[model samples]
Target: MTGGTGLFISFEGIDGSGKSTQARLLAEHLRSTGREVVLTREPGGSPGAEEIRALVLQGDPERWSAETELLLFTAARRDHLERTIRPALARGATVICDRFADSTRMYQGLSRGDLRGAVDTLHALMIGVEPDLTLLIDMDPEAALARAKARATAEERFEDFGLPLQQKMRAGFLALAAEFSGRFRIVDGNRAPEAVAQDVRAALQAQA
Candidate 1:
């Protein structure tokens, strides 16, 4: 959590790994437990961030260089943190974010070549915070790609890169979980939605 009173949880995984669905389920579960929950997503959580999101997601994947994209993402995230996530946390609400900095780390590092250091530096200097808990939905890249393709939209900039990239992204995410074990929980996403949801709930409960 960015604030003292709330619990900030973020979902991370390759596109189509069901992280978004699980994020929503967790929010619903938390709300049912009488907690005030705010569900949001990266690159587009706050109004200003949403505008930045279109620039990043709508254009051709090569429209911006890796470095330029990173800056845009950071700017949007700063706005998201200040305008939406932080405020919700300060009000003692549980913030369930669909994606966050972790995606940038993996996506840019994988697609843009060895930019993890830059990503880390930018995040530490500009954002300076992280989710208290991150739920990583692990799944086979093949299946995940299928899922991603089924729901294809104009925001296919990243998805257009194809399956091999997705596999690498999954490996990157797993490595990240190991690196930040204290704040990450890897849940198997190959199972039924209910089963995955139960696992997520159990992970959060165990953390609690």
Candidate 2:
């Protein structure tokens, strides 16, 4: 639970599954209801972590080995927890994170290599926290990859890994949702944005 009065929420899905858009929409919805919402994203929430984001997100996909990427992501996550997430939670604000440790669990742990054990170990040793609710925006991997590639952003390292990786990630995320079913909610992302947002709200209400 965050060990705080505030609620912590995270969005997870394959690349371009609209999880980021849903995260923003949820934050806005919460703020409209006059709740204190701290909208944030992992790997770059705090200043120090933003620097790490640039290093790990850009460049070639093979720039760093899975082990190295895991270390870098863990460092950024620790900084983010200390500087951003914990403080926001302490102040009793709803924290809507675009992604969290689960992303690392998929990208570095399962997709890149069999490092799920190492990822969990580092998570326990350093950033010992998880969201109160995780909304997985489930969708078709080919469509998601197409949407991700359409962005043409510099942070396309993972997108560069292509559709097969996206398919693998989609399956991995669904498995993760099942593994953490107590706190995970699967939301279909193939509908219109407003419709998807409605489902997102429904999920949160269900959690509440």
Q: How well does each candidate superpose onto the true structure, as a TM-score?
A: 0.97, 0.99
Point out the worst 10-residue segment of candidate 1 by lDDT. 106-115
List pairs with backbone clashes in candidate 2. none
- Clashing residue pairs in all predictions, respectively, total 0, 0
Identify the candidate with maximal lDDT: 2
Candidate 2 whole-model C-alpha lDDT, 0 to 1: 0.96
Q: What TM-score should be assigned to candidate 1?
A: 0.97
Query: Compared with the true structure, what per-residue lDDT tens digits does model 1 show for residues 1-208?
Result: 4745899999999989999999999989989989999999988999999999999987676888888889999999999999998888888898999999999998885556788899999999999889999999999999999898899688878888889899899899999999999999999999999999999999999999
Per-residue lDDT, model 1, residue 4, is 59
Q: How displaced is residue 47 in candidate 2, in Å? A: 0.3
